[model samples]
Target: MFRILLGREGRVWREALAAVLAAEEDLEVVAELAHTDEVPVVAARKRPDVVVLDHALPGSLTVPDLCEKLGAALPGSVVLVLMDQRGGALSTALARLAPRVGVLTTDATPWQLVESVRQLVRGETVLDAKVAVAALTARDNPLTDRERDVLRLAADGAPAKEIATELFLSAGTVRNYLSRVIAKTGARTRIEAIRIAQASGWI
Candidate 1:
């Protein structure tokens, strides 16, 4: 049997995944974790052959970061990310981490999820066609790369001063980027701009 580890915050989804995996003849869920912070520990203990992760966890860490870390920690393991249909950033980040990992949409049927997991176990990357099309059809932003970077930092809940410090720009420059992002996204406030940029997959 292929051992698997599951990571997701939602109790209902976790239960559903467990039920689906349990019914598979060749797959076994060796462990399940609720938070990204617990993933490393659980992985170290379980040493599963595959890890199915949810991308909507509450933390500063992104799915790509988790995949990178897990890849390092368990060189023989494969990471498969489960993302919401509208999770643009998650899709972009997973795409960037391709070949090392694969992505599946939450709307996927149980059979699809099991098949994706099997594909990942065979060292193949699988991306849902609808999710791929959605990513391609997302709006392209007019903001410069630096402006997008600033907006992403803001979306991660970083303050303007911290963002400026991290980007090595003056606070005023950070504010200017925020203003440009707001205007490009047609949002009234920085928070709204961040949300819009994230939703459009610009960041």
Candidate 2:
């Protein structure tokens, strides 16, 4: 059986999807979660073959960052992300994850979901055609590459000092970059800036 781990904030939605996947003869749910923060930890412990995550799962890290973490925790496992109608803020960085990271719309049938999981486990890429086209044609990134670097670290809950250290810059410079990011995104705060950048697929 293929060990599966699921992460979605909605109680009803998570369990319902779990039931659908579990009913399949070749799959077994090793773990289920309601928060993105729990995914890497649980997945590390369970060592599941596939992890299915919802983009809206409540947590500090964005879906892409969380997926990176999960990948590091279990390099052999694959991820199948369920995107909302707005394409769940698909990004170029995400597309780079390729076969290790599959994408599907939330409206996909239960059969599609099950098959996608199996395909991911079989080392096949499963990207929704519509979302891929939409993401490719989306607006260009507004922030500079440096600004995006800072915001990406910020999205992962890194403090200004930590971001500065990682980027080999001063903390004040990091803060300045964050401030510019917020202004460029027309956001009221740092978190809002990160969200705007993510939703716009800028980072």
Superposition-based RMSD of candidate 2 using all C-alpha atoms, in angstroms: 5.9
Residue by residue across 109-162, what tens digits does model 2's lDDT show?
Answer: 999999999999999998888668757866777787567778878998999998
- Model 1 Cα lDDT, one tens digit per residue, 39-124: 88889999999899987553345556778999999999988888766655457667777666888888888899999888988878
RMSD of each: 5.4, 5.9
What C-alpha lDDT do the candidate models reach, one value each? Answer: 0.79, 0.83
Backbone clash pairs for candidate 2 read: none
- 10 residues in a row with least lDDT, candidate 2: 84-93
Model 1, poorest ten-residue lDDT window? 55-64
